[model samples]
Target: MFPSKDAPLKIGAFCSIAGQVRFMCSGQHPTDSATSFPIYSRLLKQPEPVANGGKPAGITVGNDVWIGNGAMILPGVEIGDGAVVGAGAVVTKNVPPYAVVGGSPARLIRYRFSEDVILQLLAIQWWRWDDEKIKREAAALTGPIETFIERHSVAGTATK
Candidate 1:
């Protein structure tokens, strides 16, 4: 129901893209007294178009991210790279890189890593590393950050 492989499209890791990810609006409705009644009726009768109670926008997911089962990513939301959205999270805003977010409104619990370490990892761009190289470094990948850095630090650089 989407473009074929020949077309250029972006996909992320472990995400279940059921509906229109690019142009999905959780569809929020205003709560003013004048508008609320009609919206409430519409919501009771039919809820799909009014997912976020009728806001309109699209969602953008970056690479290497995992969106858990039954998660509802709302419109105009941009999920950054290496982020993890827990199951049943109703994301209503943009998620930063490597963030682990959950809950209805989706508050930021914590970053996946320290800011400096995250920056280093981003600069390393290890996601682009070949499978074999990654496999060789699998132990280090699962090891402490300092150990990984010490072992995999740039050539000719002192181990700090």
Candidate 2:
């Protein structure tokens, strides 16, 4: 529910947040010691001590990210730019840029493209472009990798 002031939740532009995705943002009950009832609720009841250091680190989702329906993003996960979180995925860690992840504790299934292409895309940073430019370059953005690269290539670029 709450995003930390220090690292507020950063959901980048053009990102698609699907329906029923849960962002767990606040204090979690202590698992080390067994409790009959939730301690966090008790803390909420009492404000004198102001217990449980408010909201942990915020989740950061980068530009062009696609979070699928019913995905549960736990606190402190950093989903990188252009990443795709599959439906019902429970993200528990940092997802690398352009990665496609899925499963209960989401694992990287694959990357959308080769490292070189990813690098090129990162460099292009199409998400940062102005609306007019983005519209003008829609074909390049949606085109094949080689075509896109050819359209916007820096001379002497080499791929591994």
Top lDDT model: 2
- C-alpha local distance difference test of each model: 0.64, 0.79
lDDT minimum window of 10 residues, candidate 1: 1-10
| Per-residue C-alpha lDDT of model 1 across residues 104-138, encoded as one tens digit per residue | 87889899987866666656556678889889988
Highest TM-score among the candidates is held by which one?
Answer: 2
Model 1: colliding residue pairs = 26-52, 27-54, 27-55, 28-54, 28-55, 29-53, 29-54, 58-76
Candidate 1 matches the true fold with a TM-score of 0.62
Number of clashes in every candidate structure? 8, 0
- lDDT (C-alpha) at residue 75 in model 1: 58
lDDT of 2 by residue, 50-84 (tens): 23333345688999999999999887789989999
